[model samples]
Target: MILITGSTGFVGRAVVERLLAKDELQCVAVAVRRAGPKLSERVVKHVTGDLESSTDWSAALKGVSAVVHCAARVHVMEDTAANPLEAFRNVNVQGTLNLARQAAASGVQRFVFISSIKVNGEATQRGQSFMADDTPAPLDDYGVSKMEAEQGLRKVALQTGMEVVIIRPPLVYGLGVKANFAVMMHWLQRGVPLPLGSINNRRSLVSLDNLVDLLMMCLKHPAAANQTFLVSDGEDVSTTELLRRMGIALGHPARLVPLPASLLELAAAIVGKADVAQRLCGSLQVDIEKTRRLLGWTPPLTLDQGLKKAAEGL
Candidate 1:
C-alpha cells in the first residue's frame, strides 16, 4: 500500500489521480488536513489536521509500504508570520520528521520526498548547474526548512533502515499550476507587454507530468534507495524565450518590450523588488545526468509539450 500526504495539493492531487487511473485505488491512502470532497469515495482517507511535530500518523501509516510526502509550508512573496523560519520548521522540518519516524516504526519500506531545487541555492553560475551532491546552501526560510528536513530524513534512514529517496525539482508547471507561472501565463494570454525580452539568463523548469513520472519511478526503482536526484525537462531556456514560448502556446504571442535588463533590475531594486528582478533575470539550472544514469529515466514530455499542457485551461 502507498500513503500520500498533501493529497489535495497541486502535486499530490496529480499523484493520487495517476494512481487511481492505474486502477490502484485499493492500494492507495491519503493524509489530508480535513475530510473533504476533494478525494474520491473509493480511496482511503485519513484526516491529520495541519502537519506539525505531534500529528498522529499511526492510523495513516498502517499497512503502507511506501510514502510520497508532498506537503510543506511553501514559500511566499510576503510572509505575515512573526517568526517565518520557525513557522516553516514546524511543518517542513518537524512535521516531516514526525511522520517519517512513525512510518519507519510501522515498517514502511520507502519514503519519497518531494524537495525543491532552492535547497541548493537561489541561482547558479551561467554554465554551471547544481548537482545532486552539491553542498546545500538554502537561501530562505522555506529552503532552510527543507534542507533541515532532508538532513533529519537521512538520519532516520541510517538509524531505521527506511529507504528515503529525495527529488529536487525546479519550477513546476502544468494545467492547474498557480503562482508565478500562472501569472506569467495570464500576462501572455492578455498580451500584456513585459520587459523581459532582453533577459538572456537560462533557468531550468520541470513540468508537473515530468515530476510525477519521476516520483513514480522512485517508488519502486532499486537504484533510488537513499539517493538524492535532480529533475528537469532536460532543456533550459531564457526568460524571454520562455515567455515567448508560453505566449505561443497560449496562441497570443507575447508582446515583449526590449528593455535593458540592467535598467529593469535597477527599477526593481528601487521599488524593493530586487528578488523579483533576480528571478526574472538570473540563471538557475540543475544537472540531471546522475538521475538519468541511475534510474535509466527520461522526462516523458518535452518542454513544448509541457507548455501546451499548461496553456490548456489558462
Candidate 2:
C-alpha cells in the first residue's frame, strides 16, 4: 500500500491517478485535511485535521509501505504570515518529520519526498548548474524548510532504517498547473505580447508526468534508496524559448517584444517588482546526470513532446 499526501493538489493529483492506473500497486490511500468528493471514492481517504507537528497521522499510516509527500507551504508572491519561515517550518519541516517518524515506526519501507530546486539555491550563475551533492544554499523560507526536512528525514533513516529518496526538481508544469505557469499559459493562449523576449537565461523545468514517473520508479527501485536526485526534462531553455514554445502549444506564434535586460530590471525595480524580475531574468539549472547514472532512468517524454501534451490540453 502507498499513502500519498496532498492528493487533491496539482502534483499530488497526478501522482494519485498514476498510482491507481497501475494494477500492481494494489491499494492506495490519501492523507487530506479536507477530503474532497473526487478522491473519497477512489482511494482510502483520511480526513485528518490541518498538517502540523502535532497533527495525528496514526490513522493514515496503517499498512502503508511507502509515502509520497507532496504537501508543503508553497511559495507565494506576497507572504501573509507574520513570520514566513516559521510558517513554512510548521508544515514543511515539523509536520513532515512527524509523518516520517510515524511512517518509520509503522514499518514503512521507503519514502519519496517531492522537494524543490530552491533547496539548492534560487538561481545559478551562467554556466554553473546545481548538482545533487552541492552544498545547500537555500535562499527563501520554503527552500530552507525543505532543506531542514531533508536533513530530518536523513536522520530518521539513520535511526529507523527507513529508506528515504529525495527528488529536487525545478519548476513543474503540466495540465491543471497553477500559479506562474498557469498565468503564462493564460497569456500565451490569448496571444498576449510580452516584454520578455531578450532574456537568454537557461531554466530547467520538469513536466508533471516525468516527475510522477520517477516517483513511481522510486517506489520499488533498489538504487533509489537513501539518495537525493536532481531531475529535469534534460532540456534547458531560455525564457524566450519557453514563451515561444508555450505559444506553439496555444497554436499562436509568440508575440514577444524584446527589451534590454538591464532596462527591464531597472523598470521592475522602480515598480517594486525587482524580485519578480530577478526570477524571470535568472538561470536555475539542475544537473540530472547523477539521477540517470544511479537509477538508470530517463524522462519518458522529451521537452517538445511534453510541450505538445501541454498544448493539446490547453
Candidate 3:
C-alpha cells in the first residue's frame, strides 16, 4: 500500500494514475481535505485529513510502503491574505511536517517530496544552470517554505530511519494545467500579439508525462533514496522560440511584436507588474545530468510532443 497526499491535484493525479497502471502496486490511498472528485476504481481508499491537523491516518498508513507528499500552498496571483508567506508556510512547511511526522510514526519507509525548482532560486544566471548540490537560496516565500519543509523531512528521516527522496521539477505543463501557462495558451489561441519574441532568455520546462515518470521511478529506485533530483524535459527553449512553437501547436501563426525586453520591462514596471515581467523574462535552467547518471533514465517526450499534447486539450 502507498499513501499519496494531494492526489487530486494535476501532478498528483498523474502520479496516482501511473502508479495504478502498474499491476505490482496493489493499494493506492490518498488523503484529501475534501471528498475527492470521482477517481478510477484503482484508488483503493480516500482518507479525509487536513495537513494542519492530525486525523486517524494510521489505518491508511498501516502497511503503506511509501508516501508521496504533493500538497502545498502553491504561488498564485492577487492573493489578498494579510501574510501570504505565513499562509504558504502554514501549509507548505507546517503541514508537510505534520504529514511527515505521521508517516514516520506509521512506519512508512520511503517519503517522496514533490518540490519545485524555485526552492533553489527563481532563475539561473546566463550560461549557468542549477545543479542538485547547489545551496538553496529561495527568492520567494513559496520557495522558502518548500526549503523549510525539505529540512523538516530530513529531520524526520534522521529520527525514523525512513528514506527521503526530493524531486525538483521546473515549469511543469500539460493538459488541465491552470495558471500563467494556460493563460499564454489561451492568448495565443486568440491571436494576441506578444512582445516576448525578442527575449533571448532560456528556460527549462518539464512535461507532466516526464515528471510523473520520474516520480514513479523515485518511489522505489534504490539510487533515489536520500537524494534530490532536478528534472526537466532535457531541452532548453528561449521565450521567442517557445511562444512560436506554442502558436504552431495551437494552429495559429506566431503573432509576435518583437519589442526590446528593456522597454517592455519599463512599461510593466510603470503598471506595477515588475514581478510579472521578471518572471516572464527570466532565464531559469536546471541540469538533469545527475538524474540521468544516477537513475539511468531519460525523459521520453520532447517539448514539441508535450506542447502538441497540451494544445490538443485546448
Candidate 4:
C-alpha cells in the first residue's frame, strides 16, 4: 500500500490519478484535509487535520508500505503571516519530520519528499546550472524550510533505516497548475503584450506528467533510495523563447516588446518586486544528468507536447 499526502494539490492530484491507473500497485491511499472528489473503494481516504508537528498520522500510516509526501507550505509573493519562516518550518520542516518518524515506526520502507529547487537558490550565475550536490543557498523562508526538511529526513533515515528519496524540482506546470504559470497562461490567453522579449534568461521547468512519472519510479526503484535528485524537462529556454512557445501553443501572437533587462529589473525593484523581475529576467537552470544516469529515466513528454497540453487545459 502507498500513502500519498496532499492528494488534493496540483501535483498531488496528478500523482493520485497516476497511482489509481496502476493495477500493479495493490492499494492507493490519499491523505486529504477535507471533502473532495469521490474515490474508488480501492483507495483509502484519511482526513489528516492541519499539517503540523503534532498532527497524528497513525491512521494514515497503517498498512502503508511507501509514502509520497507532497504537502508543504508553498511560497507566495506577498507573505502576510507573522514570522513567515516559523510558519513555514512549523509545517514544512517539523511536520514533515514528524510524519517521517511515524512512517518509519509504521514500517514504511520508503519516504518520497517533493521539494523545490529553490533550495539551490532563486537563480544561477551565467551559464551555470544547479546540481544535486550544490551547497544549499536557499533565499526565502520556504526554501529554507525545505532545506531543513531534507536534512531532517536524512537524519531520520539514518536513525530509523527508512529509505528517503528527495526530489527537488524546478517550476512545475501542467493542467491545474497555479501561481506564476497560471498567471502567464491567463495573460497569454488575453493576448497581453509582454515586456520579456529582450530579457534573454534561461529557466528550467518540469511538466506534471514527467514529474509524476519520476515520482512513481522513485516509489520502488532500489537506486532511488537515500538519493536526492534534481528534475526538469531536459530542456532549457529563455523568457522570450518560453513566451513565444506558449504564445504559439495558445495561438496568440508572441507580442513581445523589447526592453533592456536592466531597466525592467530597476522598474520592478522600484515597485517592490525585484524578485519577480529577477525570475523573469534571470537564469535558473538545473542539471538533470544525474537523475537520468541513476534512474535510467527520461521525461515522457517533450516541451512542445507539455506546453500544448497546458494551453488546452487553460
Candidate 5:
C-alpha cells in the first residue's frame, strides 16, 4: 500500500489521481485533515485533523510501503502570522518529522518529500543555476522551515534506516495552478498589456504532470533512495517569452510594451510591489542534470504542451 498526505491539495490531488490510474499499484491510502467526498471507492481515507508535531498516524501508516508527503504551509505573498517562521515550522518541519518518524517505525521503505527551490535562495545570477549539492541559502521563513525539515528528515533517515528522497522544483504550473501563475494567465487571457517585454532574465518551471512523474518514480527507484533531486521541464525562458507563449496558448497574443526594466522596477517599488516585480523580473534557474542522469528520467511534457494544458483549463 502507498500512503499520501495532503491528498486534497494541488500537487497531492494530482498524485493521488495518478496513483489510482495505475494498474500495478493497487492500494492507495490518503491522509486528509478532514473527511470529504470520497475521491474514489478504492481509496482508503484517514482523517488526521491538523498537521503538527502530535498528529497521530498509526492508523494511516498500516501496510503502507511508501509515502509521498505533499502537505506544507506553502509560501504566501503576505503571511499574517506574528511569528511566521514558527508558524511554518509547526507544519512544515514539526509536522513532517512527526509523520516521518512514525513511518520509519511502521517499516515504511521510502518517504518522498516535495520541497521547493526557495530552499536555495530566491534568485540566481545570470547564467548560473542551482544544483542539488549546492549549500542551502533559504531567504524567507518558508524556505528556512523547508530546509530545517530536510535536515530533520536526513537525521531520521540516518538513525532509522528509512530512505528519504527530496525533490526541489521551481515554479510548478498546470491546469489548476493558483497564485501568480494563474494571475499571469488571467492577464494574458484578458490581453492586458505587460511591461515585461524587455526583461531577459530566465526562469525554470516544471509542469504539474512532470513533477508528479518524478514523484512517482522516486517511490521505488533504487537510485532515488536518500537522494536530493531538482526537477524542471528542461527548458528556461524569460518572463517576456513566457508571457508571449502563454498568450499564444490562450489564443490571445501578448500585448507587450518595450518598457525599460529599471523603470518597471521603480514603478513597482513605488507601489510596494517590489517583491512581486522581483519574481517577475529576476532569474531563478535549476539544473536537473542530476535528476536525469541518476533516475534516467525525462519530463514527459514539453513547455508548450504544459502551457497548452494550463490554458485549456482557464
Candidate 6:
C-alpha cells in the first residue's frame, strides 16, 4: 500500500494518475483536508486530515509500504500574513515532521519527499548550476522551511532505518498549471510586447509529466534509497526565448520590446517591483547528471513537447 499526502494537488494528482495507469501498484491511500470527489477503484482509502495539527494519521499510515509527501504552502500574491516565515514553518516544517515521525513509527519502508529547488536559492552567480551535494543556502522563508523539513526528515530516517528519497524540482509546469507561468502564457497568447527582450538570464524548468516519472522510479529503485536528487529537463532557456517559444506553441508571433534590462531593474526598484526584476532576470539552473547516472532515468518529454501540450490545453 502507498499513502500519498496532498494527492489532490497538481503534482500529486499526476502521480496518482501515473500509478493508476501502470496498474503495477495497489492499495492507494490519500490524505486530504476534506473529502472531495471519489477516485477510481485503485484508491483504497481517503483520510480527511490537516497537516498543521498532530492529527491521527496512524490509520492511514498503517500497512502502507511507501509514502510520498507533496503538501506545501506555496507563496502567492496578495498574501498579508504577519511574519510569513511563521506561517510557512507551521505547515511546511512542523507539519512535515509530524507526518514523517508518524510514518516512521508505523514502519513504513520508504518515504519520498517532494522538495523544491528553491532550497538552493533563486540564482547562482557566473552561470553556475546547483548540484545535489552542495550545502543548501536558501534565500526566502519558503526555501528555508523546505530545507528545515529535509533536515527533519533525514533525522527520522537515521533513527528509524526507513529509506528516504528527496527530489528537488525547479519551476514545474504542465497542463492546468497556475501562478506566474500561467500568466505568461496568457500574455503570449494576447501578443503583448513584454519589455524582457534584453534580459539574458537563463532558468531551468521541469514538466509535470517528467517529474511524475522520476518520482515513480524513486519509489522502488535501489540506488534511490537515502539519496538526494536534483532534477530538471536537462536544458536551460532564457526568459525572452521562453516567451518566444510559448508564442510559437500558441500559434502567435512574439511581441517583445528590446528595452535594456538595467532600465527595467531601475524602474522596478523605484516602484517597489524588485521581485519582478529578480524573477525575470534570475539565473537558476540545476545539474541532473547524477540523477541520470544513478537512477538510469531520463525525461520522457522535452521542453518543446511539454510547451506545445500546455498550449494545446489552453
Best by TM-score: 5
Candidate 1 displacement at residue 289 in angstroms? 0.3
**Comparing 4 and 6 by TM-score, which wins?**
4
TM-score for predicted model 5 compared with the true structure: 0.99
Considering TM-score, where higher is better, how would the candidates rank from best to worst? 5, 1, 4, 2, 6, 3
Tens-digit lDDT track for model 4 on 1-314?
99999988999889989998998876698998876777887788999887889989999999999999998889998999999999999999999999999999999999999999999999997679999989999989999999999999999999999999999999999987778888898898898888888977889999999999999999989999999999999999999899989989889877889999999999999999998898999999999999999999999999888898888888
TM-score of 3: 0.96
lDDT of 5 at 204: 97
**Which pairs clash in the backbone of model 5?**
none
lDDT of 6 by residue, 193-214 (tens): 8998877988889989889999
State the C-alpha lDDT per candidate.
0.94, 0.90, 0.87, 0.92, 0.94, 0.87
Judging by TM-score, tell me the better candidate of 1 and 6: 1
Backbone clashes in candidate 1 total: 0
RMSD of 4: 1.0
9 Cα displacement, candidate 4 (Å): 0.1
TM-score per candidate, chains pooled: 0.98, 0.97, 0.96, 0.98, 0.99, 0.96
Encode model 2's per-residue lDDT on 1-314: one tens digit a residue. Answer: 89999888889989999999987766689988885675535588898777799988888999899999998888898999999999999999999999999999999999999988899999998678999999999989989999999999999999999999999989888877778888887888888899999998988999988999999988889999999999899999999899998887778888999998888899999999998888788888999999899889999988877877776665
> Residue 230 in candidate 5 has what lDDT?
98
The residue ranges of model 5 lying beyond 4 angstroms of the native Cα positions read none
Tens digit per residue, CA lDDT, model 1, 216-238: 99999999999999999999999
Deviation (Å) of 237 in candidate 3: 1.0
Candidate 6 overall lDDT versus native: 0.87
If candidate 6 were superposed on the true structure by all CA atoms, what would the RMSD be? 1.3
Q: Give per-candidate clash totals.
A: 0, 0, 0, 0, 0, 0
Candidate 1: worst 10 consecutive residues by lDDT?
19-28
Comparing 1 with 2 on lDDT, the higher-scoring candidate is 1
Q: What TM-score does prediction 2 earn?
A: 0.97
